[model samples]
Each structure stands twice: as structure tokens, then as C-alpha cells.
Target: MIKIFEKRKIWYGISLAIMLIGLGFAIAFKGLNFGIDFKGGTILTFNMGEQVNQDKVQEVEKVISDFTKKYSARETNNTEIELIIQTGAIETEQVKELKTKVKEEFNLGDDYLVQEENISGSIGSELTRKAFIASILSCIAIAIYIAVRFEFEFGVAAIVALIHDLLITLSVYAILRIRINSPFIAAVMTILGYSMNDTIVIFDRIRENKKKLGKVETGELINSSISQTMRRSIYTSLSTLLTIMMMVILVPGIRELTVPLIIGIITGTYSSIFIASPIWATLRDKKDKKNPKAQYGKKKKTSEA
Candidate 1:
């Protein structure tokens, strides 16, 4: 089998470098297009009485785009043309007006179906705040749980891995210009929980090894524990990925949700095994060095004297 954890430092360094590059892109580009969940905007979904043609859709989109451009009160720098459409619940009268205009312009009959959703600035602000709070709280809860289960160092290492996975995922979003919204928030939180679970499983094995192999090098022990747990982790992640892939490709109305889940699960699993355990081993080694009892011959000298 491939020795993934044999060069733990190199793997960790590569992951860190990818994360930093992604972070820089995010900072420089502001973010992948923050959806209306973060920055309030209107959403409209409609079907013409006749089969919708590309030419007609483009024409209608041009008019609606111009209308939004003039009426939009927010200072949005990048407002690209909107062609991709999806189904969503709408909640405002202005959306109805836009639909009416589209129908009139296209000379559509009553058979045309139109829907509109308008989110106010204040509500968007509240949603954004809640998302931020939830993410922080999740990290705190995971830290407490890990610390209680193993040790403080284990908890710290898990959190570092969690943060690393999150940043890397977000950076990809920024670079790809994916829309960030409530669903994205859900994805991030879900990944955090999943990542921590994987870390905990590995940590549990490490704890077992620590008890079994007394006085072994920390690095060697970590490597052994990780190797023992590698098969189970790969199996679990592959099963989950299969389900997510099915949803993304086969199911309608779930493409957005499944895409992020697939990305999160893959990255989360990788970080837990490679990033979290290695960092914990490194920290534990440092701690061991600081203690006289952990030295090679100190215990023997004390007993003899």
C-alpha cells in the first residue's frame, strides 16, 4: 500500500501551501460571488407559455438585467448576465411586477408560470451574522469534545486541520466564482462535523497505540495508528462520495447541494488523516522532550541514584 503518512511533513506543507494560495486569491478577489443570502438581491424563476428558446430567454434577460441595473440600490461591482435558472421560493410583490413585465414583453398567455423572491438588506445581514456565529460555535464544540476524548493537544490539532480544510474549500469557491449562500454555509458546517469525526477516529487509535506501545517514538506510534485506521477511513469516505456523486449527477434540484458535499468529504477525510495526526504527533514529541521523565536515560539514572 502507499505510505501516505511516511512523509507527513511534506504532505502537510503542500496542503498548507494550497490553502495559503487560495486564501490570497480570496482576499484579493473579495470572494466567490456572495449570493443574495449574504448580499440581498432578487431571484426570479419563470417559464414561458411556449417552450423557452435561447433567443427569447436572452432577450428577456437583457431587459430584466437592465431593469435591475437601474433599480438596484446596492453598490455591486460585478453583476454578470443571468442565464442559468433554478426553482426557489419567492416572497415579494416587486418580483410579481418583474414577472408581469416579462409576460407583457413576450406577449405570453396565462399559461406562463413566473415566480419571484425578494430578500431585504436587513434580513440578509441577520442571516450572515447567524452563519458566522454558528461556524465559530461549531469549532468550539468540536474542540471541547476532542479535548475531553483525548487531550488538549489533540483538540488543537483537530481544530487546525478543520480550519485548513475550510480555508482550502472556500478558496476554491473564490477562484471558481461559485455563489456563496446559505447552502454554502451548510456545506462548511457539515464538513467541519465530518472532518472532526474522522480526526477523532484516528485519535482514538493513537490513544490505543499509546497504551499498547509504551516508550515508542511519538512519530512511529502516530504512523502505526494512522496505518491501522487507513482502510476504514478510505472505505467510509468512498461510500459517502458515491452517494453524493449520485445525487449530483442523477437528481434534479440538488446539484448545488451535492457538489459542495462531495468536495468537503474528500478534503475533510484527507486532512484528518494526513494533516491532523501529523501535527498532533509533532506537538506531542515537543511536549515529551520538555519532560525529564520522557528522556532516554533519565529514569534509569534517577532509580539508580
Candidate 2:
């Protein structure tokens, strides 16, 4: 009974406002921190014969800092240290030397483990290209599937809603200053699949309602379809979100993966119900108005005109 579609303009406006503000921040701040997955970096994992102390780690960090400056002969920003340390990448020789220094300082044995890895710029660029291509292909495939299952207009509306969700998610990351990396790409892809599923459900209901309520106005039919499926959509999205929230709060290393996922699922669900369905309803109404068959019922009048 609640006429959500009737207030489509207001909802659309709100979505646009949030998206624009996010866009502004992204453009100004350069969209959070792009990690080595896109910019190339080293990945190192160190294994210790004994548990390392914080002071030892700090001392090792300082030594690495001095060594990098002398080796590269470049003065880098302090912020770069945070990025580099998290990546855990250093040269093999450097790792061996660091192990020797640490062993002498802590009197450890050769059982200590140290690993080093380095990623080049070309490889990082290739990864960025692949991620972009995957996202585009996903959108195209979903558009084709929606069109085949419902109508072209419905498909277009779904794609638009999808874009809206992606942009909004990106904006949130930018505003919140989350680190962008491989996990972020995975989250984006997962959200894309999720939002598509939600859109398909609403589109299916619209198709069913259209066949059953032939005499109902297109807008009213859309409203009815959404109303019928609202509970299911909310319940499903909420349950998923709750699990993600738990992981983000309880887990230490996986916060990066879970945070973006939580944001994507919430916004994706909202867009499917509020943005995609309403736009499809409006388009369907316009199409029906132009079709004479859709305007008149199948029953014949008894010489009425």
C-alpha cells in the first residue's frame, strides 16, 4: 500500500547528492590510498625463531629506513614508511643482512625465517587494467541478462542502479580514507554480483505482476511489486550485513576486506529497491502509454463506441 515509486524523484535526488559529495572528495583527495597492487611494491614475510619484541621491530624498521635512503639516495616522505612496512617487501640480500643484524642483537640462531618479494610497475599496471576490464565486462553481462529476462528498459535501469551503487561505494571509501588494494577489487566484484541478484528479483516480480494485473497502472504495478518483495530484500541484505559486521569488528587482519563489503552490500540493496525498481517502473509506464494494446484491456465492448 505504501507508494514508494510515487516519490522516486526525491529518492533519486538524495542518491545523487550523496554521490556528488563523494565525488568531490575523491577528486580533491585523489580517492584514498591506491596500494602497490596498482602502483607496484615489494611484499615480504619475515619468520622468527622466537617471538619478536616491539622495540626490536622498531629498531629493525629504523635500520631499514636508513638503508633504503642510502641505497636509493632519495629522500622519501614519512607516509611512505607506513605503506612500505605494511607491504612487507624487501630485497633478498637486505633480508639476509637484516637477519644477521637481528640475530647478533637478540642472539638468535639460524632457525630464524625471513622472506622477500618485489613487484614491478609493469605488473601493477597490468593488474589495474585487468581489474578495470573485469568490472566493465560484469556490467555488460548483467545488462544483457536483465534485458533477456525482462525488458530492455528494465535492463538499462538495472545497469544505471549498479553504477550508482559502485560510485557510492567508491565515494565512501574515499571519504573514509580506506586503503585500496587487491582485497578492495575483490569486494567490488562481489558487490557487483550481489546488486545484480537483488535487481533480478525485483524485475522478476514486476514481470509477474504485469501479467496478472493487466488493468493496473504501470506505476502502481511497480509499487505493488516492490511492496511484495520489500520484506525479503531487507531480510536478506540485513542478515548478510550482520555477518560482515561481525567479521570486521572481531577479526584483526581482515578489516580491509570486510569494511568495503559491508558498505557495498548496504548501498547495493538500497539502490536496487529505491533506485533501480522505480526507474524501471517509470520507463515501463512510458512504454505502455505509447502502446495501444497496453492501454486497452483484452475484453471487447458491446458496441460501446
Question: Candidate 1: where are CA atoms >4 Å away?
Answer: 1-6, 49-63, 66-98, 105-107, 111-114, 294-305
Per-residue error for 62 in candidate 2, Å, reads 6.9
Off by over 4 Å in 2: 47-114, 289-305
Error of 2 at 18 (Å): 2.1
- TM-score, per-candidate, Cα-based: 0.81, 0.78
Residues 1-305 of candidate 1 have per-residue lDDT tens digits of 34555688688777778767777777788656676766766655555555444565567767667445422221111221122222232335545666788778877777555444666667878998998899889899988988998889899999999888887787677667676778888888889988888889999988887777766656677778888998999999999999888877666345556777887898899998889987887777677679756542111222554
- TM-score of model 2 vs. true structure: 0.78
> How many Å off is the CA of 215 in candidate 2?
1.9
Which one is best on TM-score? 1
